[model samples]
Target: MDGFLDGLESKMRAKTVRDIRALRSNANLLREPHSKSMGEGLFELRVRQANGIVRVFFFFFAGRRIVVLSGFVKKSQKTPRSELRRALRYKADWEERFGHGRS
Candidate 1:
């Protein structure tokens, strides 16, 4: 999340921050310019700027806290497989270290 926010211009950064706050209250907001499910239990928070698109990948934890696994600037229409893979890896690592993947 830090990485994604850092790469944005001032105006974009502000708008991104606002959208993220909204996501906290409602995970299933309007897609395209906000958030979307990426299969499994993973979701992506989308922040757009004229420069590019920034995405923060996250998943819910046992106590309903959002765990932000990875953030990156996306290019092109496709969400890069590598980025999704990294987020999935991080999510697994987090669960292993903490929740033990328990329900």
Candidate 2:
């Protein structure tokens, strides 16, 4: 899991890394309920996977062919407001760095 996630992490620049890691870990744990928040088309997309619920927020950089920014989780019945806020912050940061475009 580390190797796969590390590969994914390597493609990201510094600003979005933390959120990506959180998202990946959270995704792996998904079996519980969750929700996501979004603003300005940037989103924290939460979904239920086999293990639990994963929350990921991202904006893509089309030219880069990268997710640009993403994060996930597997615990918690509801996605916390603070975490969603953090993901939103990261999404903003990603837009700032990469300039939002079609993903």
Candidate 3:
């Protein structure tokens, strides 16, 4: 996620960062245009700039915490399956490492 943010153009990166902060502030209340559900506990944080559209995949866990899985600069209308798979893999790894009963 850090790499993803770092790779963005300065303005886009700043905008994405602000969007992420907004997500942090209102994860439960966030809805379409800004965020959307991708099923299987996955949610997407959408960031659009003049350059392109970026997406960050995350899931709610450990009470109010949101676990970010993966991110990408969208190039098409539909998200690629490979990216989804990557995010799922990360989510599984996270569960294995920290999903244990800690809150």
Number of backbone-clashing residue pairs for each candidate, in the order shown:
0, 16, 0
**lDDT of candidate 2 at residue 11, scale 0 to 100:** 29
Ranking by lDDT: 3, 1, 2
Q: Which stretches of candidate 2 lie over 4 Å from their true place?
A: 1-37, 60-68, 100-103
Give the whole-model CA lDDT for all candidates, comma-separated. 0.79, 0.49, 0.87
* TM-score winner, 1 or 3: 3
Identify the leading candidate in terms of TM-score.
Answer: 3
CA deviation > 4 Å runs, candidate 1: 28-33, 100-103
Per-prediction TM-score to the true structure, in the order listed: 0.80, 0.44, 0.92
lDDT of 2 by residue, 4-81 (tens): 245433323232345454554463343323423355555454444344444455543564333424455546665577
RMSD, candidate 3, Å:
1.6
lDDT tens readout by residue for model 1, 10-103: 8878877786777677775457657888987899988877766778888888645677787777777889999999999998899888975446
Q: Candidate 3, residues 39-61: lDDT per residue as tens digits?
A: 87789899999999999998888
Q: Is candidate 2 or candidate 3 better by lDDT?
A: 3
